[model samples]
Target: MTYTVNCSILLTELPLLERPAAAKAAGFDAVEFWWPFESSVPSDSETTAFERAITDAGVQLSGLNFNAGNMPGGDRGLVSWVGREGEFKDNIDVVAGIGERLGCTAFNALYGNRQEEFSPEEQDELAARNLAAAAEGVARIGGTVLLEPVSGAPRYPLLKAQHALDVIARVKAESGAQNIKLLADFYHLAVNGDDVAAVIEKHAKDFGHIQIADNPGRGAPGTGELPLGEWIARSRELGYDGYIGLEYKEPQETAFSWAIREHAAN
Candidate 1:
């Protein structure tokens, strides 16, 4: 049950290229992130620099998200958007290429916010098609495509774990790709009023990756009421030995004390 720091959320005070090293300095040997660059299809130079940063940092890349549009500005995702499918498709190769270079095997594809112009059925259809394509691309590299359920964003659908799992089933059935898996993000599920324990107990076998943040404020463990440590223990008991991504928010310098404690105990 090793842990991976999420550079996109943690160590954000540092420049994007420096976060991986910062994560390593804090005792993490592996890290994950959302799309770090502004553009999904960055230039060759930009791509090379990003790869170099991770290599120089000496940390394994654990997981990455496909472009989710303007994440900070409230665009939950774009893969499922009607006019944005092309962009999502274009970014798949880029994400897969980077993941392959970094030895990353988990890729998350966010189901975009529901557009008023498009009916729910229409959006689901588009999402299925795009996710299928993404699954195919990542499968070529022996990577698993992850479906995550986000919370507190009404416009974005798939706020519940079941919703994301249903979509995973749909993508698998449609594409006949068996590498599709669930990314069980406890923070999002708790925010959406889910019984995190029950969900984990029922669906842990289907999960390929897991992320954590204490709820009520999306803070690090122990800052909130979430029993994150307990849940993690339960997950391990359920036969999940993969990386547990630390996807919380805190001051960069002090963010890893809890993880340090865990490491020491181990």
Candidate 2:
């Protein structure tokens, strides 16, 4: 039952730079995060502090996201956006740089939502190119690029396992990229009405990373209706050997107790 706390979402009780240490104090030696900086290309000092925070706390940076562009302001991602292609391209090397610095190898690229400005076909064409560049950039570090199908963002196009898989296939075939893979987030899949068991039984091994949260409420393991323990076990049984990322909403103090107790019982 190996786990990595999603510091970006989990330890919000503390400041950003302090969450890695907080995760360590909570008994997790590994952590993941969304883009930690507001800017895609952060200054040298900002980059140094983030890298040092992870290293100094003695926690592995298990996963990270490329800049998704003002998430709080209703932007989801730039990969498929109409006019932000260069920004997405610019952030590629920066993401690779940070990943290189922290020895982190997994990177998530959110597929931007469908836009009226550009046709869906146009957005997807651009996404293939951007995702290729992303894959190539991180390929230098022996990294895998992750594409997730998330819920709650209605305009965001990638919402099902097959939807993301279709894009992965296109990226590989159209752009000759092999490093791009699926980020199978169970809570999102379930919420989007995907057959979680079918995704696991068929494509569990296709995942580059796995995130979990209880469904119906998007909380920690015991706070909702998901059979999260069985899901993890079944994923393992089907050959997924990566860390199970705790990407959910809950109070910081009580967040890890559920995972700790589950681990002990197992």
Candidate 3:
């Protein structure tokens, strides 16, 4: 039951140093960044600077996002596994190297949406192949990659957790790799009408990590329709010991920070 920060909110604003400091001020002990390595943070200096931030803030780097279509000329949101297999392998290797160096072993994997013209089944198979290879590369660096499903996003063809589980099952059955697991984001689940608790309990074996944001507006835990307490209670009931990632945008810095602090204090 650790509180962690998802630095997506700082993607455009906030200097990298201020990101961790903000988390610390809010009483969080862990932080995660979405593709921070690819941003202005230099490859050689990023790790050292990031490590200092963590120490200064008394927090840890939870993990890094592999990449997303949000970046210009990025994979366009489907992981580009269908036709860009070589680049996929290369990207995984690069991220894995960074993960090993930064003491971050977990990563978020989403299939960036492909062109609508591609067959859904074809895209699925391509993603499956790419993930299997990515898993192998991640394992070499003592890490694991979690496949996250982005529902309600026009770009995602496989937009459900169950569907991602099916793909993971098939990949495991075919390649015998267990390094790959499910990364469930409550925000997407709420939009797609998935039962967060039930999915977590029923498919606990397939889950490696979790992210959270309120429904509708994608705000803080207490800001929207998500029953944060219920999910936390059920998660604890179901024996989930992994980090609960806070991925959301705050209207103001501490609008809901007090809620998290109170929750932690309690």
Lowest summed lDDT across 10 adjacent residues in model 3 is found at 69-78
Runs of candidate 2 with Cα error greater than 4 angstroms are none
**How far out, in Å, is residue 119 in model 2?**
0.4
If ranked by TM-score, best first, what sequence of candidates would result?
2, 1, 3
Question: Which candidate leads in lDDT?
Answer: 2
lDDT of 3 by residue, 1-266 (tens): 67677866632367777778777776677888776655322465775776677668777877777755355454434354466666566677667776776577887777777667778778877777777887888898778878877765566656678877888898898888888888878788768877777787787545688888887788777778788768766776776777888777775455456465767798
lDDT of 1 by residue, 1-266 (tens): 58899999998888999999998888779999898778879999998998898899999999999999899888888768999878899999999999889899899888899999989999999999998999899988899989888987889888888898898888888889888888999999999988899988987877889999997899888789999989888888887889999999999767987776767998
User: Worst 10-residue stretch by lDDT in candidate 2?
Assistant: 257-266
Q: How close is candidate 1 to the true structure, as a TM-score?
A: 0.97
Q: Residue 119 in candidate 2 has what lDDT?
A: 92
lDDT of candidates 1 onward, in order: 0.89, 0.92, 0.72
Estimate the TM-score for candidate 2: 0.98
Q: Please identify model 1 stretches exceeding 4 Å from their true place.
A: 264-266
Q: What is the lDDT of residue 229 in candidate 3?
A: 67
